[model samples]
Target: MTLQNDLQSALGFLNQGKFKQALKQSKGGMKRHKSHPDFPNIAGISLSGLGKHRDAIPYFKKALALAPGFHDARKNLAQTLLFLQQGEPAMKLLERVLKDQPGDQAALYLQAQAHLVMNAPEAAIVTATAALARDPRQPRMLRLRATAWNTLGDEKAALADYQAAVKVNPNDADALQNASLLLARLMRQDEATETARKAVAVAPQNVEARRRLASQLISNGDSAAARGQCLALMELDPKDTQVLEMLARISSRDQNAELLPVAQKALKAAAPRSLDRANVSFALARIADQAGDKEAFAAHNDEANACMAAQTPYDYEGSERQFSRIMAAFPDVITPAETAPEGPRPIYVVGMPRSGTTLTETVIGLHPDVFPLGERGVPAFLLHPCLDKDQDFTPEAARDFTADDISRLPEMPKGTRAYVDKMPDNYRLLGHLGTAYPDAQFVHLCRDPRDVALSIWRGYFSGSSLTYAYDLKAMAHRFNLYGRLMQHWRQVMPGRIYDLRYETFVADIEGESRKLADFCGLTWVEDMAHPERHEGQVLTLSNTQVRQTAHTRSIGKWEKYADVLAPFIDGLNPEIWPEIKG
Candidate 1:
């Protein structure tokens, strides 16, 4: 085949996600016309698309070498470098691109997302805002701004940007999907459902959108429709693990064992991810237990346990530095105005993503006098004063503060003394939380690092924001860093943080709740044992699980699969409640 034809085929395959084929074709094209003007450029695009990032570097360099001013090739090369985890180099190219063409949409979008992920949200917002100004209706740009807003603690603004993007591009499946997820959490059930429905309608063949809408419906108590949607999604992508898992979870009436076969099917096919396999196995076991098939339940649980991956310690020096930079950028936890607690009041629960945060929040919510904010951004993340205008935040994160902003913060709500901000990722800003409400008690929940690692891997998270979560070792390192930070907070900001344990809570709910109550300076409420009964009160992701109360079954359930946890089995800190590590 001619160089051009091979390149064309490579482009086609690249766009189709047939990376291997694209790589093959691009290599073939390069060999045919090693000297062609555009061949190197095509080779660069195709090879990078193929994920042969290192090999593609020369091609992009060659392309730029041949045509020094080719914006398209330059842009592709820059982004390709970023994809190869070469963020600094990519930043240099993007900066050059922006210097040349300040209003370049692709450059701006790429630069913004890149910066956001690299702990440069202020820079991301700056570029993203410029991108939006040039093309206000650009779906990607809008989402970029929304994300930047989110990272900077402007939940309302983020929602507004996302909503606007959805409005401008009603058929944008991603926009609809995110809007649904966000609104659902914000307690706009009807809007969330409608938005998700619209997303499914617009992209009828999009199995993901269908699944999302269905899940939202299920959460909103529209299980009947959720089941139908899940079934429909199954029809399109029969083995889509997410669809299969959701179906298995929803169709409990179809004989608990029935879903097992489906889950097994998805698992056998390597349907989506390892997490799905774990979830399916767990769900099947749950059903078996319900069905009185103890042996079968044990077996399934054991198999699910087998899915536990191994672990290795990560020498994530670069990541550590980046995290340090992010911490430096947003140093203080921006909190609501109520600096001093006059009495027992709303406590903000801040920690990492899966650190026993939800459980701690639920315990706090169990208090009769306190209201549960769940994970909603009420005194929202964006409520921080520094979010105004455009400032890319640094990882060495510091609060963008002013005396006036502090002055304007609302006083303690009439009678509500304790409000909980259960932003798990808010640990990086613990001091800010302290400053936000000197009187507010901050509970920093910690769990076994191994359990957190295994849990995250065995779950489907936003694979984008938390790139670290994809790898077990990275997850462990991140967890360790979090532990170090919490430990530091205790040393410096002692008395403000109450470390909660997952195992202790499981072993003795009453004991833990009373301890929690004492920590928050509240009278222990007897009703906390029935955590699920306070369903409406939970605003975090645990809404579904909190329908009744605490269940002892979840604690230490990892034992069923403890043997299978190869990758992250022992990645936890050696001193994590030394009594329990054994």
Candidate 2:
């Protein structure tokens, strides 16, 4: 064929996805028109389509060298560089492309992708926002911006973008699944379940969509529906570790003994030292603990801890430094709040995780006039802003409270005389709470530290912020800080704070429940002792436990795992152990 005819044949073959034929035709055309940019560009396209990206690079360079102003060839080269993960070079080329054509949507999208691949999420957010400003209906651009926001730890912003993406394309599976997960993390379980269900409905054969639906179901406390979804995932892929682990958890919760072997068999057959194996091992540990197999429990618990700890080890020294700074500021900063109660007052129930914060809140929630805002994180948000340039708190910061600051606080339920904010970590922000809400009261829930540590270790927590729970020494450090901080609060705000010991409450439920009700300024009600009957959704790890009648069996539960826990709790203060053990 002649030069023009040969190029035409190659272009036709490329368009039809006959990459090998296109490459042969382009080579023949190169012999006739060796100086033409289109010949080399066609060859590059052929090689790229045939999955030979490295081989395609030289041809793209040759095309650009021959036709210095060929925009399409430059764009193709940038895309190829991005595919090879040479993001710096790809981004440089994209910057050149954008200088000429600032509104080039394709170049902007690739630039954003390159930034994200290089772990520069802030840059990606800027670039992706530009692309979306040009064409807001583009689902991929919306999803890209959502991912960048999530990487920046802005979940609400990320959720907003995901919602926008779903609205742009209701059938977009990625957007639907992402929005569902964010909703779940925000503890809007009912809405999360509906969104995840839509994802599954849109992409029925997608394994991840179904998995998200299953996980959301479990979080919403619908174990029965989650079990069905897990079974469906098994049909999709019998060896999915997540499916196996989830099945193990649901089976253990349901007391379905036979299903445990299915999970154990898959776990035993899995390769050693994998995260999947570690997770399943942890699941089996929980089952063993429930079955009273102490030896099995100890062995599996160790394996799981080693695996998880390797991934996210404890930072005991770092944590100690941070807590020391917070405590050191107490003498100057831990004073009374200046603002009076503008509306419904808030009573905080504060303590370590699994230290009866939920139980105390549940008991207090039974009072007809008290609204329990379960584990709301408003104070944590407020405290972060008051830190100085060195990230340390100062007395000056504490005293700067304004009545207008109450506007920033989370709104209490509309028609209640008083509300309970039962965030356990509020123990760390008692000083801030004291200054911002002078009328606010505090309830400190105290539990046996050994039992507290054991509970935290035995259960799995979702966030990296709780890294201390994954290791023993780290847990001891956490427990110690909590004890010292509570003592400081008692000294600083004596009569405004009330302490409810878990052991005492368990032994004398009526007396302790009445005391809790009275402390919150509510008249004692007989129903306060039967918190499980209060008809509210508890969205904590203790969701299952709180729904059952009060029981004392969890008292002294540390003794059962004493052998496994001795090494971890060994660093605990000798003086504190006696106080808790008594």
Q: For this target, which candidate reaches the highest lDDT against the unseen true structure?
A: 2
For residues 479-509, write the lDDT of model 1, one tens digit per residue. 6677666766676576678888777775677
- lDDT (C-alpha, whole model) for all candidates: 0.66, 0.78
Q: For candidate 2, give the lDDT of residue 280.
A: 75
Model 1 residue 404 lDDT score: 27
Counting only residues 3 or more apart in sequence or on different chains, how many pairs clash (N, Cα, C under 3 Å) in candidate 1? 60
